[model samples]
Target: MNIKVFIYDDNLSRRDSLKALLELSPELEFAGEAINCSAAVQDMETCFPDVVLMDINMPVVDGIEGLKTIKQNFPHIKVLMQTVFDDSDKIFECIKNGASGYILKKDPPQRILQAIQEVYEGGAVMNPSIALKVLEYFKPQEQKSPLSEREQQVLQLLAQGLSYKMVADKLFLSFHTVNSHAKRIYEKLHVSSLGEAIAYYYKNLHQ
Candidate 1:
């Protein structure tokens, strides 16, 4: 079955282009398109999309709030955010709020298609430039990895965009134990949020 994609971008040209692109791809179907996400929930509920192509910067309701609403209501639907530039703060916010992927507006068509597929298949994707910005956004104050071997393993999985539960299952550890290691990792890294922790992982621990 083709993955259904809904677009939420204010740019008419971009929306049109995306619609045309979707028509060309056998793996994707254009469920619907919207001007903005002001009615994010209603739109998603109506369109019944498997993945959403969300524009991060919209006029009335930007992707951030729309992402929040969708994740809150329809946790299974994947969202892939696109922006004209690598806005690190927005990127951090989106990731923290459960955005499945982030990509540049200027990225080639093939990459965008690949991102949608990857996210639909439960993998997190980030533009390389955006990934670099995410690391620089939270430049660790310390380089030393205070994390134990288990903590490092947990963090590495998290960095790959695995959820805590997924990491626990992959490592054959209880979910509560994984949570404990995550908490310890945060305390040791002097970071307090998921986005910051992932950034710290890339900055300090990622090989």
Candidate 2:
């Protein structure tokens, strides 16, 4: 099925470009577009889009605030942030506010489309630099993970780019046991993916 996409951006040119791109991509459908997200909930409800491409800077209500509102009202709809700014603080804020993905505005059109598809398929997407920043941003926080020691060990291995099988072998555990530990770690960390769990662990590792 084609992914229904809505756009929220203050720049007329950007909006037009996005609309044109959607028109050309067979996998994507243009649901709607808005200049800003002052009435994000209303606009989103009207469109009922599967994904929203949101710009960070806007008049009155910025993308971060708009993202919060949209998530609050329509938690099922995925929101991907598109912005020229790559500030760590803003990126973290958007994630905490429930944004599904973050892509730089300077990214190629194909990358943006891939991000939308990734988010729609229940995967989180971010620029490689953004991912590193996310990991670095949490390096100084106190550890607050509720995972057991075994789970922590598994997660640590996972964070070091180990595959599940590799982690299991290193820890002298069965594959099922390793998978179980990873699942528990995700639950305790309130994250959905290994990347997010690693980010959370780094943030609270000092504790």
Candidate closest to the true structure, highest TM-score: 1
Give candidate 1 regions above 4 Å deviation: 143-207
The sequence of per-residue lDDT tens digits that candidate 1 reaches over residues 109-164 is 99999999999999999999988988887785656578899999999999999999
In order, candidate lDDTs are 0.93, 0.90
TM-score of each: 0.68, 0.67
Q: What is the C-alpha RMSD of each candidate to the true structure, in Å?
A: 16.3, 14.7
lDDT of model 1 at residue 14? 97
What overall lDDT, based on C-alpha atoms, would model 1 receive against the true structure?
A: 0.93
Model 2 weakest lDDT span, ten residues long: 138-147
The most accurate candidate by lDDT is 1
Q: Give one digit per residue, the lDDT tens place, for model 2 in 64-123.
A: 998999999999999999899889989989999999999999999999999999999999
- Residue pairs of candidate 2 with colliding backbone atoms: 138-203, 143-204
